[model samples]
Target: MQADVETPDYLRDAKAAGIGGDERWSIVDHVAANPRAGDLIVGSGGARKIRFAAPGRGKSGGYRVVTYYGEDDLPVFLLNVFKKGDRVNLSKAEINALREELSHLAREYRQGVMRYVKGR
Candidate 1:
């Protein structure tokens, strides 16, 4: 089954990082095809980090996408996107904050599903 794709507000700011429209589409398509693809970033609340090649650019000069796929039933959450080398690895404190925020996000998403089903 193809997982639903979702780009959060932060990810939508890809333009700021030189991620063009076509490149974004490619990233979305690739993630949808391979939902579990990417290296799991430990302590980031289940976020998977993937390297994506920009149009005409190899992976060395591509982008990084941080995503969260909470469950098979849920949509793939594009957490953040950035150009390579723009930032170093996240610190422990950053990961801790992200973990908490992601946990809250997942809870809200799941609750929304339940509410929808109950209403139906």
Candidate 2:
């Protein structure tokens, strides 16, 4: 089954990164087609970064999509994105922060699902 998707505020506000409505949908479609397409960052709260070619740009000029798929049961969270040269690598400190936040996000999401299921 295709996993549900979630986009965090940072990514949603990346207008400077050139992410438009079409680009966003393209990303959603890409991940929905292949949820495991991205390479897992060794550490970053299970986050993965995937490359996406823009409409006229090739892979070299593509954008990087940072996402987190905690498990089979959880939705794929689109955490952030940036152009290829916008940033190089995430720092250890950033990853550590993600670890803490994503943990809480997962727990809350699970609880929300359970409540919905039970309420139904």
Candidate 3:
């Protein structure tokens, strides 16, 4: 039997309902602080930068991004699918800042990607 892999819309709705701004942000910060552990700087095509990446994840059609969620799977994917990796051996504030910045950068990156793709 093919187990359902697609994320349910109810889950999305539940998430939306369950997490307010600060709660969601705290969860994001916790994930980034703990599981993901670190971030890497990446330059976009427009010379803009992003946070969090493993080395060889740059290949193929994959994105080298820094998303807030995906704690359980991303490291595995980054390690197994890519090369070159590191975690922050820095202070909590620094890691928190990096995670927060990564969250912002991911938003900008997504907008930029949409614009780029739509323009082309």
Q: Compare the candidates by lDDT and give the number of the best one.
A: 1
> lDDT per residue, candidate 1, 85-107, as tens digits?
67635668868887998888777
Window of ten residues with lowest summed lDDT in model 2 = 4-13
The global C-alpha lDDT for each of the candidates, from Candidate 1 onward, is 0.77, 0.77, 0.34
**What order do you get sorting by lDDT, best first?**
1, 2, 3
Clashes of each: 0, 0, 1
Please provide, for model 3 over 1-120, each residue's C-alpha lDDT reduced to its tens digit, 9 standing for 90 to 100: 111111233235325434345543443354344543335433211111123222334323222222233333222111111112322233456445655654554456458768999999
> What is the RMSD of candidate 2?
2.0
What TM-score would you give candidate 3 relative to the actual structure? Answer: 0.28
Error of 3 at 25 (Å): 33
Indicate the TM-score of model 2: 0.84
